[model samples]
Target chain A: MKKEQMTPTPLVQAIGLGSAKAGFSHWWLQRLTAIFLIPLGLWFVFSLAGVPDYSAATIQAWLRSGLNAFWLGLFAVTALLHARLGIEVVVEDYVHTRWLEVLIKTLLSLAMASAIALAVFSILSLVRGA
Target chain B: MSQPQTSSRPLSPHLQVYKPQITSTLSILHRLTGLWLAVAAAVLVLWLYGLAFDASLFQALTGFFSGLFGKVLLFSWVLAFNYHLCNGIRHLFWDAGKGFELPKVYRSGYLVLAASLILSVLVWLGSL
Candidate 1:
């Protein structure tokens, strides 16, 4: 037989085409962040609810407290991560056009990175500015 | 390779074909609220940035939120946040291999909805 006929085509499903090895980490990290956010989220809600005012001084002082600053910062970071992961899945599910999906995902990554960066910076500034 | 014609082939599951169930509706709501929360979180980060960099900006943002429209939006965010949170916990339970029974699933669905409502009310009330 000729060389073209000798080798059979590879099985697509068997090779798992369209599989990104990154899925498990994405899923696992999403869950892990969710777990962390449970306490962080609750603490944030209750603490903010209890705040007497949203005035600059009051908000600043509240965040300036060591534990509050620590937890809020942690919460911000974790929740941002979780949100990015969730958004990625949403895009993957609904975005059918390959290029548009790619573009959106790329933009999402950039935006999420900036958001996380600004969140950290803002939190730090709050604590330090206090 | 030649492409196989698929015009006559049976298509995959579409939203129009399936009757909506509590489980499916809630699942979609979880995703929808998750997206809303992501947007809410970005706004929150922006609020933090305002507070950190410029107190006047923060005050302006706060002023806007004190309005009626803002109040509605803020309340919706609180409800969305609570809904996502409670439903997320339900998802975690399923991940743990529990709460798979149909009756249990329906019970938990209602429970999540009630908890979300109560939590949102308590939060708004507590803030007031």
Candidate 2:
């Protein structure tokens, strides 16, 4: 007896044939951000943990150091990026309404943008010895 | 017309049907850590904003954070940090298209748990 073979659909041929294809970009971004944060997050925690108290000037002093500032900026950016990606996945998975999903995604994007802006501003201020 | 698949009021897998696994604990811990970090970040924002505003406000805020409750919060922060960091590294490996086999998955899961706990303890001991 001869067996029939499976064939790809026209739509599948037009666009790559798989569920894993589309979501991979988002997955990679999330992983990239996570990888970036591994060491930077550790540095942030260790650097801040040593401070005797959370005094304003002490915090400023910590941020003032070049190494600390570098890691702080890295952490800031990676964290905002990671949070946005994670939240986006959650919304995409759970939020079914088209309008609601769009709204949530937009809000998350804005939040991430705001976080980066604030972080950059603070980093610049510290760098300028403000 | 054909009938729809998976539309017979299909039964879904439930917890009781399967034995518990180590990765399940790690998954739950990841969510819990995410939550604790959110709380810590909120407190951190309050501190940063207070410092940005005025010295008096900063003093009031710092006083609270340095207090007993604050210490507890920071402890949890470190715990969450360690857990998330180690588990996140595991996630990174998965993202790289590795560690799909059963033994490797369980092994790495246990390693992540052990490392986070050890690191958290060391940090706590060092801080004291």
Candidate 3:
């Protein structure tokens, strides 16, 4: 046999096994947003503690302030993103069935998206002094 | 890897026969608390929506949260949040290729537990 014909193909190449490239981005973003959340979460807890009243007007006023509204928006967005990523990891690990996994993941993405949208709208309304 | 014989045999260390260790327990709790926090975030969105929309609805929701059951639920939720945060930091350390030693792992686990409890108590008191 010719030399080129005698070479054996690597098993992985022959079998066409390829990397999924899923976990790295999810893992990195989860950690990055987690780092963001540490300070943001603390700020949120402290800000809530500082709220002297839970009345609607009071909360609206608090949220209306430019700085508070800005941070709240950041917090809401970062938190939802982080949460969606974390839950995706759990689902990937535990949901063994492919269709069920896809279904659950889609539902989760929709829920998170809606939550982020509603939160941002609420913040905007508050900022608009509505 | 080869497919082993499919026979009726007690598989390796099934949950029923396994004694719980702190590491495994904490790991499980991490996932559970993460799930709980996701639900809590949804509730938060509702509260924000209420605040922006209706006064009476906001009042009712606030009142509910201020009641006895709500206080207990909030406290537990806070605890879960703290625990998850602390353990998440520990996990990040592991991801960086550190803290894999057995003693250090257990030590960090206990530290996370204790810090979570203490921080939760402090936060609740501060809120009150």
Candidate 4:
């Protein structure tokens, strides 16, 4: 066989493929946080529904309980993280421009982070009777 | 590979061409509900902050949330939240490489919708 014929074809030339591996972790984390949110979210909703009064004192007292506070914090973190992941997928699917996509993702990340921090801080404050 | 030219390329099927099906409809709803839930989460944080910060502010927020418009919004939020949760479970099943059959997919889609509506109603009634 001639030298050119004997040489193996480049994989990209033969297969015409490119990397599509970046989104697996994002997808997996979305599912993971989603699983965590199931029970936590159900519990939170039921508890909130059972609250007879929407008064601040009542809500604060509910949050002051260690278990409630802990679960609330966990729910907030998991939920916001899950939301960010989901939003990221939506943005990726719809937003075609690279710069625009990056901008939206950054804004979403910052917003989710701020929401999580505010939720956790509020929970802690309530637990401390602040 | 060379990229296709933007102007002459055929576009993918979207709402205009495609007939609406349960699976596609649910998928869109899932994204929308997820978006709404993010906003709801931010509002929740605000409410918590109000509760923690000042009684007056908390009361005002609570009053607003208890009003008719607020009640409607909360009801919709509850429905959206449950729908998203149920559909997330369905997606997890798909991730596990199960329930891809057409019948199963349609069944699960309807199940999620019904469960979400029923749960939302129960929660709303319980709160009343």
Interface RMSD of each: 3.5, 4.6, 4.1, 3.2
Q: Give one digit per residue, the lDDT tens place, for model 1 in A1-130.
A: 7887763444533464566578889999999999898888878887887899888889889998768888888899899899999999999988877789999999999998899899899988788874
lDDT of 3 by residue, A88-112 (tens): 9999888867789999999999999
- Which candidate gets the maximum lDDT versus the true structure? 1
Model 2 Cα displacement at B64 (Å)? Answer: 3.0
Span of 10 residues, lowest total lDDT, candidate 2 chain B:
B1-10
lDDT of 4 by residue, A9-101 (tens): 345353646554666788778889999999999998888988878877787778776698999899988988988998898898889888899
Ranking by lDDT, best first? 1, 3, 4, 2
Residue B123 in model 4: shift from native, Å?
Answer: 1.0
Clashing pairs in 2: none
Order of quality (TM-score): 4, 1, 3, 2
Q: What is the C-alpha lDDT of each candidate?
A: 0.87, 0.74, 0.86, 0.85
Task: List candidate 2 segments past 4 Å from native.
Answer: A1-22, B1-8, B15-19, B54-57
Give the number of colliding residue pairs in candidate 3.
0
* Poorly placed runs, candidate 4 (over 4 Å): A1-22, B1-7, B54-56
lDDT of 1 by residue, B27-111 (tens): 9999999999898889889899998897788888899888999888888888998999999999999999999999999999999
**Docking quality class, candidate 1:** medium
Model 2 C-alpha lDDT per residue in residues B1-128, reported as the tens digit of each score: 12123344534556677666787878778867865675565455445545555567678877876799978888889999899999888877886789979899999999988999898887877666
Candidate 3's TM-score? 0.87
